[model samples]
Target: MTTPYLLILLVIGLGAGVSSGIFGIGGGILIVPALMYWAKFSQHAAVGTSLAILLPPVGLAAVTEYYRSGNVDLKVAGIVAAGVLVGGWLGASIANQLNGHTLKLVFGLFVLLMGAYLTASAARAI
Candidate 1:
């Protein structure tokens, strides 16, 4: 792969990783949006890709099928790993500076917002 493409993937991963570490999440919440906008991935493609990367230990056999079906994006996964490796460090540093109670409150608000969004999206799809 070219350096530019590699760098872009790393950037996507870093951004996702930052939020992942901060919010104690590892998938869809950040990765999906980043992939959709930056990587030009469809929602299902992005989700399947993210799941494949994160759930390998637990769902190797399942993801293997998805990979065969062209649901997984290996390039995106590589980029995510590169970015996550760096972003996780930065996020952990920032999170360490916040008070425990405040962090919990912020996390709670984020969870509520995500739930609302998910609910609305599901309702619309139905």
Candidate 2:
């Protein structure tokens, strides 16, 4: 890869990392979209790359801090992780069968709905 290309990746990783750390989100929320748009990756490639990027450094420091602060629940997390392992495989299999445009449309709707739900929940709380 060229230096400029590497730089683009660096920026994407950094942005994704910061937002993930702050929001407790999977970096795929940002990384996959950034890769698809900025790096010119197909939807499947972007999702795969995002998953690869998350395989290591899976928020170790953040988890540690949350655990220290009495915010981590190991059993619940383990159960969720177990589900994710199976679900991720199934989701990836389905995604692979989708065309790029259809995948993007689905992804966009998912994000939009989540954002709306979060905003509404916060408004209710406030």
Candidate 3:
């Protein structure tokens, strides 16, 4: 990749990392939009790449912290994690079958809905 492309990736990565650390949210929320806006990546590509960056170790540190705090519900988490693994694989397979435009539309709608739900929930809590 060119230096400019590498710099863009670095900035995106840094933004995603900081957002994840501060919000306890996945990079998908920030990364996908930034990739589409700044890097001119297709939505499908952004989502796929974001998922690639999120596997395994992303949860390791958080899991350890929870475990140390005696807040790790291993059995519950194990079952949920298993479901997430299966569901994620199935979702990816389905997305892979979709065209770029269709995937972008679907992902965009999903993100909008999620953002609305989160905002509503936060409003309720406050």
Candidate 4:
């Protein structure tokens, strides 16, 4: 990779790490999209790479801190993690079979729907 690409990856990694730490969100949410947009990675490649990076304890320290602060829900997190493992595999498999444009469109729609749901839920909570 070129120096510029390396720099981009470093910046993307830092952003993803910080976002994951602060929001307790999987890095895939931001990382995949950023990689697609900034790094010009295909959706499947971005998702696959994100999964590879996340397979390790990338956020273990942050998660442990949250647990120590009594902010981590182990039971819920375990269940969700289990579901994500299954769902992510299925999603990635399907995405790999799709064309890049189709994958981008589907990913965009999914993000839009998720954003809408989060907005509604936040409003309701308020």
| Highest-scoring model, lDDT | 2
How close is every model to the real structure, measured as TM-score?
0.48, 0.93, 0.80, 0.82
lDDT of 1 by residue, 1-126 (tens): 788768877887776555554554556567665666677775556655766656543235444666788977889978987897698667657756776556546655776898999899999999
Error of 3 at 5 (Å): 2.0
Predicted candidate 4 versus true structure: per-residue lDDT over 8-38, tens digit per residue: 9888888877877888565667889888889
TM-score of 3: 0.80
lDDT of each: 0.66, 0.88, 0.82, 0.83
Candidate 4 backbone clash number: 0
In model 3, pairs of residues that clash are none
**lDDT of candidate 2?**
0.88
Residues 20-46, candidate 3: write the lDDT tens digits: 656766666788888888899887888
> For model 4, how big is the CA root-mean-square deviation?
2.1
Pairs with backbone N, CA or C atoms under 3 Å apart (clashes), candidate 4: none
Query: Which ranking of candidates, highest TM-score first?
Result: 2, 4, 3, 1
Per-residue alpha-carbon lDDT of candidate 2 for residues 28-106, written as tens digits (9 for 90 to 100): 6889988988899988899999999987766586677778999989999999999999999999999999999999999
**After best superposition, candidate 3 residue 39: deviation in angstroms?**
2.4
